[model samples]
Target: MAKILVLYYSSYGHVEQLANAVAEGARAGGASVVDIKRVPETVPEQVAKNAHFKLEQSAPVATVADLEQYHAIVVGTPTRYGRMSSQMAAFLDQTGGLWARGAFNGKVGAAFTSTATQHGGQEQTLFSVIANLLHFGMIIVGLPYSHAGQMSVTEIVGGSPYGASTIAAGDGSRQPTEIDLAGARHQGELVAKTAVRLFG
Candidate 1:
């Protein structure tokens, strides 16, 4: 069995919901332990309190050192100007030691994200995260084309071969749909199964 880590930084609640779905899928895929963690919030307290959504959900903060304990890691973030949120980017920026030591060389890595609009840089944000994972020499496990939901033409869903995602709407009024969560779950399962095969 493989130990998988699903770490993310969600401001409003969309990414958090998707993160849970992803974690559940990872466990369903036979990972022995699925630890869901969050990168610390860096915004001002007052600013965060006035956000359009609540931070009702949270998880333990993740440290770079913890990466060594998991065979697979799934990262999630909300898009910021067609890129990953500053919080997630900052968290990942601290992995110099891990990178220096090749701590994640053989681990499976994947990413998921949420954007404020349909074209709010979803692919770019996911690719940015994947780029960092590659810097650590980790094996990239993307959402495969076999996930039929990724090709849905009728529904407004979020996901691609790069990873999973959801549209959050510009005003933060939108929440993740079942289709979005399903895509996230599928990505998690794929990464988990890959981890079991390669690292278990």
Candidate 2:
């Protein structure tokens, strides 16, 4: 049974929604186990803002050991000033030990993100995530244009040829559109399937 890790940091729940969709897709693609973990909030107010989900208590803080058990990893984060959030950046930075040991060598990695606007650097965020994976010697995967929904522009609401993403409205009231969810799921499935092919 292959395991895939869905790790993310969400300040407003938008990225959490994307992470759930990605996990659903990965499970559908036959990953026997899916580990969903969230980065811990360093500030009390930030934790309070996310009280609805109790993310502070329920979202496990991922460690380098947690990363090693998975055959594939899908990282998610909210777009922060055209990049991944500082929380995620800090988490990735701690992977220096893993990088030194080539702990992620040949493993499959994918990225997902949510932004407050349509052009809020979702692609850039995904790229930044992929860049770290590259440093760790991981194989990065992205959504392919051949997926059924990919051919339909209506299904292209979020995510891209590079990775998954969501256009989270500024107010954070608008949920991800069906297309956005579908694209995210598809990206997860792609990553899972690729991991199986490469590592199984």
Candidate 3:
């Protein structure tokens, strides 16, 4: 059994759903504990007036200290110019001490994201998150080809070998599809299983 944390920052609720799906997958993967958390929003309320950001998210705001407690971490964020959201970036930026101290060394790490378009920097943003996890000395985990959802062709959705992702419309109208959630769950299972095998 392992403790897995699903942490993310979602602007329009899509990533929130993705986070839940990932957590569910972790639980199903035989983790002893699974927690879902969110990064504090950096955008000023006034600027996000029409952004449709979910105001009632229930996930607790995550802290750098929490990362030290989890056996594996699965993080998600919305795309910001082929990168992770500034909010998530800000939270991760505060972990410099943890990085230097090897606090997350050997822990499993994975990432997922949502974008406005099918090709809207999904892989780039996923890898950007992965780069930071690598610096923390964490072992990277990804949704391997074993998950058949990675090869979806019936619809334009989000899921890659890098991680799980979803296609949100430009107007933030689209939600994650079945395939997207399935992929997210797969990533969670992989991370949780890996964590348990290594740490337990």
Per-residue accuracy of model 2 over 103-195 as CA lDDT, tens digit each: 899999999998988788998999999998888888898987754554566433677788877777877777787777888899888887888
lDDT of each: 0.88, 0.82, 0.90
Q: Which ten residues in a row have the lowest lDDT in candidate 3?
A: 46-55
Q: After superposition, how far is residue 61 of candidate 2 from its true place, in Å?
A: 2.5
On a 0 to 100 scale, what is the lDDT of residue 134 in model 1? 93
How badly does each model clash, as a count of residue pairs? Answer: 0, 0, 0
lDDT of candidate 3 vs native?
0.90
What are the RMSDs of all candidates, in order?
A: 1.2, 2.5, 1.0
Q: Per-residue lDDT of 47-121 in model 3, one digit per residue for the tens?
A: 776666676799999888888889898989999999999999999999998888888998999999999998899
TM-scores, each model vs. reference: 0.96, 0.90, 0.97
**Could you tell me which residue pairs clash in candidate 3?**
none
Which of candidates 1 and 3 reaches a greater TM-score?
3
Prediction 3 TM-score vs. true: 0.97
Clash number for candidate 2: 0
